[model samples]
Target: MARLDRGSVSGAACGPDMPAIEVRSLSFAYPGADAAVLEGLDWSVPQGAFELLVGGTGSGKSTLLSLLKPEIAPAGERTGDARVLGENVADMDVRASAERVGYVFQDPENQIVCETVWHEMAFGLENLGVSRDEMRRRVAETSYFFGLEDWLHRDTDTLSGGRKQLLSLAAVLALRPRVLLLDEPTSQLDPVAEKNFLHALFRVNRELGCTVVVATHQPRPMLEYATRAYRIEGGCICKVADIASLGHREELFSGEVSGWGASRRAKNGVFSSASGQLDSLGPRGGAPGAKKGLKSGKSAEFEVQILSQDDSGVPSRVGGGRILQKMHGGSATTLSEGWFRYDRAAGWVLRGLDVTFSAGAVHAIVGGNGCGKSTMLSVLAKTAKLQRGRMVRGAASAALLPQNPKALLVAETVRGELMEWASTCGYDEDAAQERAAQLGLDGLDARHPYDLSGGQRQLLALAKLLLIGPELLLLDEPTKGLDLANRRIIARALCEHAQAGGTVIMATHDLDFAEQVADDIAMMFDGEIACMEPPTDFFADNVFYRA
Candidate 1:
């Protein structure tokens, strides 16, 4: 067991007492890795304070979170001490540490272990050996707090990404841990749900007095609730000024909090930017107003161009191009009177939805969780069959990137993953490397896919998808866990793809990414397309949908 004996450091801002968590001279390196992930890091987290960890992909934020818990801490070479609640974390028993510190993983699907929401919430209590009556009371309270009552009896698999994540949080909180650690818990959620989840955390901290620490790439919304913020870079954690003191700095408000360019000293206070490299994309045009072209009041439409060129200088007769000519004379795909559901007993997920996706355009489907956005994308990609209605596909072939990036990763190494896709697509090794570089995945060739950060895994998946060169590209939550820099790179890549006469349909909760990249926006509601229009009109007309 390692312990640190150091005098209290100033500027803790937690409370005038021993910090909830303290680390001194901490350094760690994974087995077989060449360089240390964390180097001589010193950090203090105040009791009952909401702390946020911000960094680019692979900056060791998740690794730091893992070290906070003894039960699940990664196997690594380490030096120095980490204390949780005045006790050496390394010395604590796994079960005891777990009782005091609850961790929620980034992937909710991976974290959930029970069949139903009720069972999931009660699992932790059962492990702790709580009496049946006490377990029921705790589970009931947590489920209500998280608004899971309606679906408490539903199968875990039936819930949406957002709901599953909420369930995961509720399950952890059921244990009543004093310290809560979350690693990008909202990475799979939409903007509205993300805001809601953060608010819930704020309540947990304010009402329950639980110390909260979250690691996230998207930190703008959470910033207002954060008492302190830290940036991880160069294998160390540097404390930044509180979010309140930063004021209306556009960079801070713009969701680009992954360390502004380079670190610099501040004289009076901590200064940081919410802006990122992608800020240069400039402002978009258009105003909020009623749009034409929809008779069903349930759907909306936008005009987009399809650009195609080949050896014969004629559009290739495959994928979106082939489907375009037949559907709407030039559109990529059309869904008329579409109805779908996972199971007949589950009821309809998409109800009489009518929508047309333009060819050679970047189209985004925006909606709340479980609104059939993903289901519609699946139908377009030909992954899901339309239970009822007609889907006319102009595309001879298409590529779909599922919400879970790990599903697409089959190769041992990043380079091998891209090469495999290239080989299947009849492209050379150089082409794969070029595409990888386009997505900012240039130097990660030798790294294992699973070893990469969540954002990096997403980028690798995008690289593979792009290498296939499908006419129509379907992406689900493409920018979920990515930093602003990588988001900008992906936005640029998607725009270039559209310019080359390719089609892109992305179902995402990232309004910023959609605003920056999509030419048209479709808002899905209650298993139907509530409206579709230019980004400006769509956001303006719907007050709640605006980010």
Candidate 2:
């Protein structure tokens, strides 16, 4: 777990002046694609430095990161020289590359190779034919370093998204790679979990002397520690003169009028309130008048409590379009005294919870990681049955977009995924392409579903669900990996869904998205709904849950 003493790991010269990663004239195009995603790029990273890559969805950030680790690099017509720790990426020895270069996938679950935490940590080492004693030492050291000792024996599936991601980082560090590459590592994490993970990653770069490179749309959290930054634009990588300038480029991710009544600023990517909105959380399980309005804050005035950004007045909806038809306003579904747990031996996830979702509103479940938000969605989706609760649904049709959007993707081609459910969803190929265009996925019909950026893939999955014309829509982390522009697109889509008399219940860690799009916001804490209210009333006077 310790590699801090390396003079240099790049090139033949073991000197501090050497670069850990270097790229020259790198151009790549996926098979059967229209053009190259990356073209004629030249870049370099200092040894043992922390670096960041900034780009929007489908902008080739993922492709650039993939090229760093040649073993799993995507299939394509590639022309370039990419070197990691002094060795050409394309010509790396299989064993040597696996030991020297570490890559963490955007989806934490995508890279996990074992059922249990212990096995996963050892899996990579086992492949390298590491000595038994050395593997045990590394495992124990890393487990303690990442605070994973508590769940060493737990099944990987039992861990929350945050925990799984942390474990992934720990497992990779167990190999003591000279350089680490992470793609949107904190996309699924809650605020608190993200801070913790960043701290750990920082230690790897500072204390352990491992070169770190991360690609992310959300760069605020990593800006403080980044030694350099590169942005991919028009199939080329451009070095940024001042990394701090990225924080001020609000237009990069957040400049569209929200579909809902309010606006969300993606600059800070954290929620905190100077106003005392906690007082409005009346009573116990929920705020007063919780059920009075399906669209909670159509007329109420709420003060903004910003941590860094200015209190710009609320924005207005620009486009007025409807994707769904309005149905009779009534209860979409009701969960009465819901009680559920994944395993009888495991702790209860939903404890005697009761709530009603109206037919024409966007309701968001906001909470910390591992607070049973996703589980509640599963119970509602019927993917996970509640042990002792009644789910009464008035709507005949419904659809679910899971936390991991790739779960529902069953087809090899992007067009095929849309066509797979065209018959069942009451939509044809043209409608499918139209829906895809609405979510910024129009030109990717020929690519495989797995090849898209994390955010693009999310939109594709959501397009499938929306095409179903479901009256009851369930989404988990609906905007997990999206940039602000895509977030705006999705916000409008949810607005259309609600405007059409459909009901949406989504679990998310993005409070900004919730503030701008959600009509009703519910705070889930420790297997219970701690409070529920409109965005104005919910975030106003609130002291925590913000950065």
Candidate 3:
């Protein structure tokens, strides 16, 4: 194990005492890449400074963080010196670096190791040989700091995306590192949770005196709390003297039409269900109360029977009523009396609830994270069956895109990966190549999937699903790691598919995305379908989404 000599750095050169972090001409590439993702980059974080790293997709922000922790570099791509605590990182072993600098990865699943929330929080300390009593004190302190004490005994897997992130942060805090490096920590969190998280992070930096560095596409919240901001583009970083100069910056990020008739900053708002006279609009005019959707043309009995089909497309239950009476003429799939239970949970994630999803619809499932949006999607995708309930008149074919796109990508080369999925979807060789080219993945097929950027990996996942040619597509937080451009591309793709008679159901916290791609929206509140309707009405009068 390599160790740093205390005398190597003279007086006031160690972290907290000196700079918390320092990098000099750091460049890194993956094993097979020709160009370094981070090329001759130099950066430093002064003690107690709260800084933000802003960049577009594939701009090397993540790669730089990886270099700071020395985790994601390919075996041979790292060069130059990186110092954490004024000690050269390359000379320090992985364990020492982890202990010195706390890193929260862009993906929460990548860092989650324990089953229960308490166990996950205790993991880091236990690994470092902290005693049980010490671990308990630290876990309680960190949990209380992040407002996670209520759920301390909850199963970690059952938490919502935002809650899971909080747990991840709590785990890192328990280790008590002097520096915290966060990569888009708010990406998966809902607006409320995201807001709370930012405040907590501020407290940690201000009250605890920890150096903070975060990489994000949306920079508003960061700018609000950040003392310094650096913009990274084309592998270069430049300091922004005035963050306000980014100007009407929120509008640019969210791209949503606000009441001000201007694009709202996409990052700050939340989607909510409304119950006024919204439906009075009749799906055309501006109504203030009651959400609108296709009315049941037939009796409830008939609708339930047709929706209760088994895996082989046969209805397991029969009901008395006119078969086509409930057919509202639009594509709607529903699960009646749906219920799902996990191993460690005392209650079901979904409990005997009736939910409906229509084709060409853009629905936003809004509940505190862990409200069962993912579980509901699983039933819709047929990946997991509900402990109870029957689905009726579902799409002819469906494709599911999981939150962790990385796991779905298994091919050695990007092109080969696309081809593999295409073949699985019953496409011919020539057709797969054509589809790959159409998806803007023509030349890079030969490149390894693992070597692609975060955005590229997500696009690849979509391409794989599209190759299957399903009539209905389910995407879970598809925009989590994407920038505006790639996110728009994805939205366009989903829209085009819907236009061509395909259906889409996306579960996301991106209110901007909900406004852009959804024809209709559904807000799931506490495992119950609180309200479902068009996007216009969904946002209308909803205080949570106002600019």
Residues 488-517, candidate 2, lDDT per residue (tens digit)? 677666765665467889988777777767
Q: Is candidate 1 or candidate 2 better by lDDT?
A: 2
* Candidate 1: regions farther than 4 A off: 1-16, 242-311, 314-330
Full ranking by lDDT: 2, 1, 3
Error of 3 at 484 (Å): 1.0
Best by TM-score: 2
Q: Which stretches of candidate 3 lie over 4 Å from their true place?
A: 1-17, 245-330, 343-345, 428-443, 545-547
Q: How displaced is residue 40 in candidate 2, in Å?
A: 0.3
lDDT of 3 by residue, 1-547 (tens): 0122333333234633667888888777776666666777778788889998887777788878777776654454677788887777666676676567898977788889889998999888888888999888888878778888788988777777778778888899788777799888987887777888999898888887678998887676566788888888776678888877653433322433432111111221112112100111123223322123424322232223223333444333222221211112256888898888775346778877787776644455655577788888888888887777788745787888887788788889886777785434455555556545544566576678766666677888888887676777888888877777667567655654553346678888887777656766677766678777666777885766522
lDDT of 1: 0.73
Alpha-carbon deviation at 108 in model 3, angstroms: 1.2
The lDDT values for all models are 0.73, 0.76, 0.68
The full ranking of all candidates by TM-score, starting with the best, is 2, 1, 3
Worst 10 residues of 1 by lDDT: 262-271
After the best TM-score superposition of candidate 3, give how far the Cα of residue 55 lies from its true spot, in angstroms: 1.5
**Residue by residue across 262-379, what tens digits does model 1's lDDT show?**
1111111111112222222112233222222212211011111121222233432432222111111245688999999999789799999999887767888888888888888889
